[model samples]
Target: MSKHLLCLALCFFSLKTQAQQSDFSNINFTKADAIANKYKGATLESLPILSYNLTSTLKTDVEKFRAIYRWVCANIENDYYAYLKNKKTRNKLKKDSLKLATWNAYFTQKTFKRLLKEQKTVCTGYAYLIKELANLAEIKCEILDGYGRTADVNIEELSIPNHSWNAVQLNNKWYLCDATWSSGIYDLNHYSFKYDYNDGYFLTDPNLFVKNHYPVNTKWLLTDTIIPITSFLNGPIVYPTTFKQAIVPTQPVTLHLEVKQNQEVIFLLKEGNPMDTSNITIEMTSGTYKTSVKPTINKNSDELLEVKHTFDKRGFYDFHIKLKEEYLITYTVKVEKK
Candidate 1:
């Protein structure tokens, strides 16, 4: 082989190797395994069972909501002995039994297994376990790294670095709930088993949370409204649908789709007919245009085709495309009022 050709081949191989190495750094499966391992050998406790009457009354939404509530209630206990046991092992201990800071630290590092085996953890550990359980139940929850203020002292401002809690979204609203404060010692024996589902903690006014807990994502503290996942998915795509928009007099709107590769796509329209037999027009953007034309409008039963050139002149217009038989995808674009 020529000397120049050998250099070119070596360069190509180096580039290939670099690309492969970069892909591995993007994933962190090891961290997840480490977390799981920390809780190994922990005894599995039977979760609290919902009341028979409550179970019968639960509908789809109610059932999902109740499942999460019951899981938290069943797994955590309010035993003072458990707290004392955990306090001895963990460091940076707080002398005050009611200190929220102590609770957060214990929960964050400990696992459910630790809680079951040792019967105690700090506040952070409790919050972490709660977050994990909420995730398992398919609920969206996040831990807020912030300080808490009690009536007695402004420990947070004193740089005491106290407290941790969770903000959960339910029915499109963010609610604050502090299981630690609620479950902490109460009566003489510190054996009070009553679980308080305090509304004071739920859908808390932002002003209140800001005074005590400065969340990492301040947006979570701004409103009770739970941001929908669809809002994020509705943003721009690499290959968005192209269409003509107008406003004066109602007229039929046409969308032109361009497919660069040979792939099957579920063609959809937000405001145009996907199944109009007589009024719709379909044409290939590329390739042998005539051969690529679809005969009769193919529409899925779940999809409907309707026209609204006048009503909705603003907002996004989305369409689906299936590329080759393997890839199903969609693209979207915005239309301004004319």
Candidate 2:
């Protein structure tokens, strides 16, 4: 979702492990929800229905793709409670077949159909469904098999892919999209899905998507520049809205960021242009504690600024890169207890 100037090695995210399903039948999607019906999911039998109802308002190929994607995100929920029995009804059926498959599972047509009828899926199911719908719409799409920064996935754990996204060729330009993430995340604790519709994943910038998703076929990255997996793990977590301008991080942004309690962490910023000094300001805010710091800047030329700070507490602190008081982008830092 973002970009940066210097390529520093530091990435952090967390995810819950595979959870066991439980009773969640009492929970109901609101009646006004588009995907409230059991058959609202994408399926072979529903293709004509979906094509007619969803794409009827669309006039262009791009609109068709967006319509399909919007429909999926609105109606689909990660199948968190599929296996769990509805305690009210004595009938227990295995209608959902999404069993935490590894990176190797092929997105066969059969499995994709099952995901649609059942109304749930992981990353792979999302990829397959999008591809299927895209093909039906005559839009060129590919299932981008890749290694995702799946909740706490470290560099060592990235040997195999843990996720799959989609790439669509629109107007001869290929763009990245993650239907699973766009739809919502699987909440293991609540044993349900959080309906958070995200549009950033659709037609995303390859550089930003590269922060977390590493495609097995690098071509699917759909960018002229590619960042390595190691760099991705070390680089700051970014999103598109995080930056106002394109911040390309090549190297040498940080000397060493190993900060200890009561000690300062030296921070550096290298801008491509030096004359924009009046516009840029770097600040820190602790979301956990609500404390803010505007570090004293050691301006080096118009392009570089060196700053240092000591965080008062150990928690998730956010680094904001701003232009004239407007936050353009952010980098997250984890200050731990000594």
Candidate 3:
């Protein structure tokens, strides 16, 4: 059998997921990598039929969804380096909005074609192509414009909205997926797209998704309470799959974080298995003062730890959660004087 068939075979029939929230944790990364390898440089028109066939073998919604999700991640080049490829045509307009809108309009149409021709695209193209191609397999999806967090930092005040991702309906609920992030990440130190498989993005829960993605329209959140953009920016920056189980940040965000400096900001964590008063310590290193503290933990209950701190200056702070004498996640916190 061809690698494509073998990948589709293994990926399609084997995935068993729970209904509470769709889990992409145990996704067939090998299959995803194989499929990506096959279509790596193939343009949109080059691989539509191939993409459809890969999904046609799968009968369930989740199966079809994963097939498409994996395929996109596999093949789509994030074009993080696209900026280096100077466009043949340049729009020298006085208004930045018009220029952005013009380019956005150009790329928004026939996205698959552009992806094929260029062999790369940004997050918008990734989202558009997913929705477009997934339609062939009869899956419902929507592209969402949003503000996204990057590399342990959340800047709520980006002058222009800088990111795009997707939401798909699964079992009557909307689940978030970021194909671009799945494709790869921009290496900040190197200034390049380091191509890799990042399956953490698929079918993420709304609460966690909200931390990185604050949709322009609140209606797309699909959560009980819509989080204001301000709160999303101020919340703790969580690394992939770390401390999510043992730590719950309160919202408006789950983390009880007030990002302003000179205020007593509270961090609340509800201890889970192996997370207890004895084994856990919340450690802090503040950037402004170039000093560190092991904050006093106030136990509100057996499961709850309310960590409090006040920043004297405006700068970045790093908070590391140590459980059982090992570091959990050193969550990034930014303190600004309001």
Sliding window of 10 residues with minimal summed lDDT for model 3:
13-22
Taking the tens digit of each residue's C-alpha lDDT, what string does model 1 give over 1-338?
A: 99999988764443222111112234433433333333333333532222222223334322443334334433455545555564443334554645556565545445455665654544565566556665555567777765554433342123244456776655434456555654433466655555543323333344333434444454554533432323222222211111111001111122222332322334333332122244333222222322122323343464433221221233443443322221122233344444
TM-score per prediction, in order, is 0.38, 0.59, 0.66
2 or 3, greater by TM-score? 3
Better candidate number, 1 or 3, judged by TM-score: 3
> Model 2, range 97-205, lDDT digits (tens) per residue?
3432321244344445557576666666777778887877778888887777632463434444457788776554566788777776667887678887765566655
TM-score of 2: 0.59
Candidate 2 Cα outliers beyond 4 Å, as residue runs:
1-44, 80-113, 238-256, 259-338
Better of 1 and 2 by lDDT: 2
lDDT of 3 by residue, 131-165 (tens): 87777767778899877775434554542455788
lDDT of candidate model 1 versus the reference: 0.40
Winner by TM-score: 3
Candidate 1 clash figure, as a count: 28
lDDT of 3 at 338: 75
